[model samples]
Target: MAAHNHIPLPIGQVPSSPYYIHPSDMNSMQFVSNKFKDEGFTDWKRSMTISLSTKNKLGFVTGIINKPNLQYASYKQWERCNDMIISWIMYNLDAMIARSVLYFNIAAEIWKDLEDRYDSIDAFFTKMKMLWDELHLQSYSKDFQTTTRSEANAVLDEAQ
Candidate 1:
């Protein structure tokens, strides 16, 4: 009989603490403007997700609300998180955009509406092709080599 050596799988590293996004930071955060659909949508989405996660309110953005049968304490916590997420989103949005989503009571509903509006597969591919063309056009310009390294990297990161 041969003896086998057992190896343990590595555990995932835990975050030291929940992320915190200051209210002041939220106030100053760039609004998702009209150009967001064509140019900045992915970056805006990534930043918003990170901000929500850091505030420990990502559950409200991503998760469903508790059932009516849930305990009072659970329901209260959900409500608080939902309110915080809604406030944070409203604070960071353009006035026009804010008006559109202001009536959403569920954080997940707001999140889904934004995703459905901006993150459809066709939109993603169109954005990618536009970015590729822009990069190609810039490649022929004099400063492209020096100027676009960071911008190109950001575009690539968002595409993935």
Candidate 2:
């Protein structure tokens, strides 16, 4: 056989590798200070994504680095990394939200559930805007007084 060109670095040694779990990466480590509180999912997701990316563990939740089979040598390491990622995710979630997903064993599954349940800010804003437009349309009647540009300017000056 030809010489092997690739040699796997020892565990926790390859900072760039997805499977490399840093010694400081504990299950109790909180990736972000703000917990996801069933709202502001976009901001919460962005913060967690940046933190996980920095640790090279984003793939765990993104489903890029899948869990290996039990017979594989890296299976145990994968479990450790997956569990750690799950714990980090759980820690960043609000108590109720975390408990909702507590039974999920896969990091990706928990991420998907959270995304499905709460990641709809864009749609929510769109719906709110539509409702506001509808309300504005409905609130206007022929009986209402219409202010001209000068009248609006006068009102602004008075407020100032």
Q: Estimate each model's TM-score.
A: 0.54, 0.74
Pairs that collide in candidate 2 are none
lDDT of 1 at 147: 75
| Residue runs of model 1 more than 4 Å from their true location after superposition | 1-39, 64-71, 121-128, 131-160
Pick the lDDT winner. 2
Query: Which 10 consecutive positions of candidate 1 have the poorest summed lDDT?
Result: 10-19
Question: What is residue 39's positional error in candidate 2, in angstroms?
Answer: 0.5
Off by over 4 Å in 2: 1-8, 129-160
lDDT for 121 in candidate 2 is 60
What lDDT score is found at residue 134 in candidate 2? 52
TM-score of model 1 relative to the true fold?
0.54
